[model samples]
Target: MTASPEPTDAIAIPDSPLAVLQQVFGYQSFRDGQQEIIEEVVAGRDALVIKPTGGGKSICYQIPALLRPGLTVVVSPLISLMKDQVDTLVANGVAAVYINSALSREEMLRHFAGLRRGEIKLVYVSPERLLQHEFMERLGELELGLFAIDEAHCISQWGHDFRPEYAALGRLKQWFPRIPVMALTATADEATRQDMLSRLSLTDPLIHIASFDRPNIRYTLVEKFKGIDQLLRYVAEQPGQCGIVYCSSRKRVEEVAERLLSRGHRAASYHAGLPLELRQSVQERFIRDDLDIVVATVAFGMGIDKPNVRYVVHYDIPKNIESYYQETGRGGRDGLPAEALLLYDPGDVGRVRRLLENSDNEQQLQVELYKLNVMAAFAESLTCRRQVLLNYFGEYQREPCGNCDICLDPPKRYDGTEDAQKALSCVYRVGQHFGVMYVVEVLRGAATQRIREHGHDKLSTYGIGKDKSQEHWVSVIRQLIHSGLLTQNITRNMVLQLTEAARPVLRGEVRLELAEPRLVRVKQKDKGEAVLSRAEDRALFKELRQLRKQLAEEADVPPYVVFSDATLTELARYRPKTESELLGINGVGMRKLERFGAAFLALLRRQE
Candidate 1:
């Protein structure tokens, strides 16, 4: 949050975007659809891009800024994102500055003067600033190159993290009809994309929807049993690494963070309830590699640009797929291998329901509940996890992605038509007035006082499902709800109700295939067998990591900015002994090579 602008001499106008890519960002080639998206925006046209995290989205608009004549105004949603992006650009020797509430008025005037003089190539501002009348009038006077809206999903009402302020950004397009507007996001579904198109008023735009796949990330989901024990086991398994544990509430965040700290991990808690200065401080420490883990709510990860987060553990299930995807996407941003696991329990659905009950908008409420059911289906699926996730986003990948738990060990599903019929018949017999637990008891023929009082014991559907245990029946109930043969009434304590699709299952018109329940009544091992540690080149890897920390501390930057753990891992394995050998490493650019390459090479020689 410095008040000073990045120093610059004359601008280096690149002949093409490719020149800027190599010289500034240090990439030999554009990733996925970046080349096409950049070509469209650089040629003065509107574009909408949906590239996955770590897919080099920033470069698409950044290269165009280098090639264009005037300052590119980037509308970023987070102050942390603005700061990190500007820091990286300035570190790369590009003149970039950010103006937000974090800056003083004097600093804002100075940066605006720099922009007026065309000294700054990129200017990062927030949605609030863009909506101001004075700012727009002043902006209209300048020759702006383009408008880059990072986290463009915020423009959509259906987006997981929507901002009312972003709805005002559509006026930016109308104010400067000639300046191209590029809306970019890493997370958005079909609804969100359409909303962005309509809100930004992008006409006949070049929409590049890149594949939403992170092949390097391994996905795993386990039922919650002794969850904190399991978390400890996983954390111990991955030694000297960074990860995040996402809880559903601020209280849970504090409890988990405390538990981890008591176990001797450098952990912290983050949520909306924390002081703003404390939250900002924790984020800074995490980014600087000063902490190993941060237990947080969903509010913590939106502005995180750290590349070495090795894993993300969802202590409870997220409300919807969009939120889950964005939170987990925070891992493996360096294009290195990462791990993600969600410890799910049916009890979490009750929490989700309670949260949704408070929302006043009936239309949005229904939409959110439906999305929650879809997310529950993903967590419960016995087939490919990636398949169900991608399908929800309107991308169909027929073949199973072999990177997830289900793909590795698929569950054997049994023909469940008779069982489903029985469940649906019971729901109908019970008058659709009770929730899952009571219904399960009815199926198991529990002679509870409520059942006796309602005369449910005399019903023909009673004791029909006695052969299956209560846990198995509960799992079946969840699956039935997910399969659309049943719906949960949100207003009436989430009572079980039948939708039109339930008729087929009840009438034997459709057959259901359900995964055999594997409910572990007894506690399993304390530590899971989901091993993620890859201590490559042990001896030199240790030295390289220590050196990286030293350099990061000196430069007051993240260790990743000095050289990510992945790059350091490569250095240790290859043991680059010369300048040329160091140059061949994946993340060693000219600036890095000049700064620390010789020192690393000297260490390799000493080791030899």
Candidate 2:
């Protein structure tokens, strides 16, 4: 709860680092909160950065890693993530190495030896590895300059990716108390932040809570009756663009990916249940732009550095706002325009509620549920998306973002003061033991078999909402739930209950801007053969695909198992004539360029 210190004027700025940041990273200047956080880390002070997932949290640590002396030990949560970060670091000419479960004993020992020799400037390790006795002893031998905990929120039980080993990190202070530790996370609410501080044993750390507003990301939440058809239409409209579709389960991930593939789109499935090799292959393909879309669970995309992702579609609502923010942050990292869509239903909320009940820590569970309530409010809110998100992070955003769906096409809001009172009265009369559907049915005068069986049709409030349809009543109830006027009783079969905040609204003391009910409209498809007018370019693209197909075939891989269409599109667009140019593409690497660059370039030249 402490405020961040005022910025000091004594910090020196070098033109070289600024030039690299602007020219290579393509940023004009540091964002408002970024400079102070960077200076604090540069000064070797322990700091905690709570920025929104696309708010440039990486830059906070990356800049300090570049400026500080000695190597920075980055403890990440996943093995695949370490590989991605190390690859990017090496690409940028920063000496980096990773030790993870993927490595053999000897291989890991070699990396540990490298760390002791100070041969690497950045060493990425998983929390599990850090818990190993041998790895701990090896780490003790190294002269670490800075200890960075990426996704630091995971150290708290409240975080989405909470790992038991992260709690073990408190022992780091025992070994190297003098070394500054910078904990960086894209999403952490106030309670989660405090939990992280206590769990990590951070000493009076400077907290940098950046504004969570993402202006480039236009937020939209739609009723999810016809989600798949809507998703297909949205993706088809943005042809060849990279995006991620997040589902709740592995089964859904595979099903969605297969459905997209069947519809003639480049897509793939990713989840933790897959074989390590298969997961790596899918991740490589997606990163290389060999796949246009990746249907994945929350397990994917941690520390993924792909910047040009255009959209993130949530097939189900996440458990909390932190999870949602981090997942959506995956899109639009390149500072380009992107969209985040959440397709959800009342069933999704039930699923999340069950998950909360199943968690081990009751306090953390309550905190997470509260965060979910906030996210639900955001989804059902009639105000600007940017404003709601920023407000959650304790920042005031006055004006509408103009880019979000609600801002572009504002929802119709009726004066719901009286309706609020009726809903509240109904909940109170029904004994707070019935769910939204039952409550709504009673209000709509629906005398279905269940309603009559419960004898609710005889109640005075049973037909009060006869003027509105069932769907309309449901929307009003949902909005009221989000407004803190109503609470879902998870223990009592997820029933609706009135809270203290409901009194003013129920008594017609406060006006509420409730959103209108949304309808799902199916999209029309175009049935025509795809045409290519650029014969020469099309021929080159074909040859590139063929060559990729050949390489993948030799490797016993899928077509996208080699290079993605995005890479091919870039090849066709840039017409890169050399291996060097090819290596500069988003997903192309030195290994790939060395192996297949010549053939791709030769085909391009032959076409010319």
Candidate 3:
């Protein structure tokens, strides 16, 4: 980190946002939609930004924070997020501090003094702290420039991770009418975006919704069978890389973490059930690259700024697309190739549905169940996973994304026109009032009590599919839902309902093709795909990582805070021989070049 403030001369034109981007943040140019958003904020207009994670959302505000006058107050959701961002900014020679519970009273007062002296460009605070009367009043005393609310979706109930404290943030606009408020989030659907605009009272904000596609992330959905073995195999393939495995329960988290440890992986469990200090330690360890994997429940991984997460494995399905997208988007933040592997089981659908049904709020439960069905549909989708994901967020992509598993290895198809007709006919005959399990049972000639009570046994469709296994029928039904020939009504007990598209298929007017039932027990590929493909580059990258880890240990910061893996990969790829060439790299600013240039240059010199 720089020992003193960055000289104003570093940015040749202090008021120019592009100049500040290159000089202070070391980016050669603004990413698409970033420069316009930054200019809007700098021009004193509110903005609601809906960009995907790793999409440079921070740059939309950070550059403006530097170019605009006065201190920019950023509202972040987690202390770790604040600290990581502040550390990154400090490393880049920008004066930034986070005011949160982590700080001692003396440290808080020192930061307050800095703020009073106008020595800090940005100050981060939590929503709860920002709402405190004294802190709110104290902020009024400063020459406030902008209020950038990170994870702004938390303010809305419609968002995946809603916090009541965020709802009170609308007072910021009322308290400081002229200070432009920029609410930014990586995950927000249409409803969540509208709710945020209303809840945060963003005044006629410029809404910039960047394409929600992470092309670098390869989406893979694997059927869950012997899930522990599958998880172990997946993790084994990515040895020594940092990743997160998300489970649905604390017990599952512990079990997975224990199994991983037994298999000799650097792993730990994190959940709210653990002691606060233990959770904090696990998080810190993971961020520092001391832990190769963290098996955790949904309680973890909000506002995580670790850019080099190689993969995110969902040991179980997520509750919604927003949660799934945000969680999986945690990987490949460094614009490097990464993977999102979800081990999906049909049984998990019932478990998740039951969990959501317990919610006392009927409206909320309905919303959750609807989202869960959509999540399941995505998992069971036959088409491009990226297409299904992006289509849900209202981004239409006609062309298939070649990075996903479906595109890479297309499933074997068969002429299942008769089976599709059978499934569709069964749904219609059974009155379309049952879930997949019940429908499958009816089709498979199961004489269960519920079936007898409903008199479904006497229906024409009953036992029509007896030749097919229950798993086969279930796959057919799910595929039909994904093909848009049927819809599941979540509020009506997730009953199967035929859509208009099903009419033609049921009447045999349109031939249908479906995937063969995926019951074959398969093994994960044992190959490890390294980002640095060449042996010599990988060797140099390893040495650079070692150097970074040593420096981070000495500096008491996460290794990424020194230099992201992406930057290190670039350093290894393009062996810069001089200071100018090194500074030309994307992540190296003047401050970092001055601080660690000679050490890296010496290492490169030795590599020669």
- Candidate 1 lDDT by residue in tens digits, 1-608: 33444556434656887888887778898787888888888889899998877777889898888887787999998776787788778878888989887788788888889878868888888999877899888887888898999999888777766778988888876788888999999888777898899999986799999888887788898767567887989998988799999999899999889989999999999898987668778888999999999999987776567999999999999988888887888899988989899988777988898899899887667667766876886786665777666655656655678999877866657998888888889999999999888999999999899999999999999999999898778778876765556766644656888878778778777777876764422222233111224564676788888988988899899988988666776677656665545766667776898788877888887866
- Score each candidate by Cα lDDT: 0.81, 0.75, 0.83
Instruction: Give me the candidate number with maximum lDDT.
Output: 3
**What would the per-residue lDDT of candidate 3 be over residues 138-238, giving only the tens digit for each residue?**
98899988999999888877777777799999888788989999999988877788889998788889999999999999998876756898799889999
Q: Top TM-score: which candidate number?
A: 1
- Which regions of candidate 1 are displaced past 4 Å? 1-5, 8-11, 275-277, 414-608
For every model shown, what is its TM-score relative to the native structure?
0.69, 0.67, 0.69
The residue-by-residue lDDT of candidate 2 on 194-226, one tens digit each, is 778887777778888877777788887775655
Off by over 4 Å in 3: 1-13, 274-281, 412-608
> What local lDDT score does residue 582 receive in model 3, on the 0 to 100 scale?
74
> For model 3, what is the C-alpha lDDT against the true structure?
0.83
Give the Å error, residue 449, model 2.
29
User: Once all C-alphas are superposed, what RMSD does model 1 give against the true structure?
Assistant: 17.4
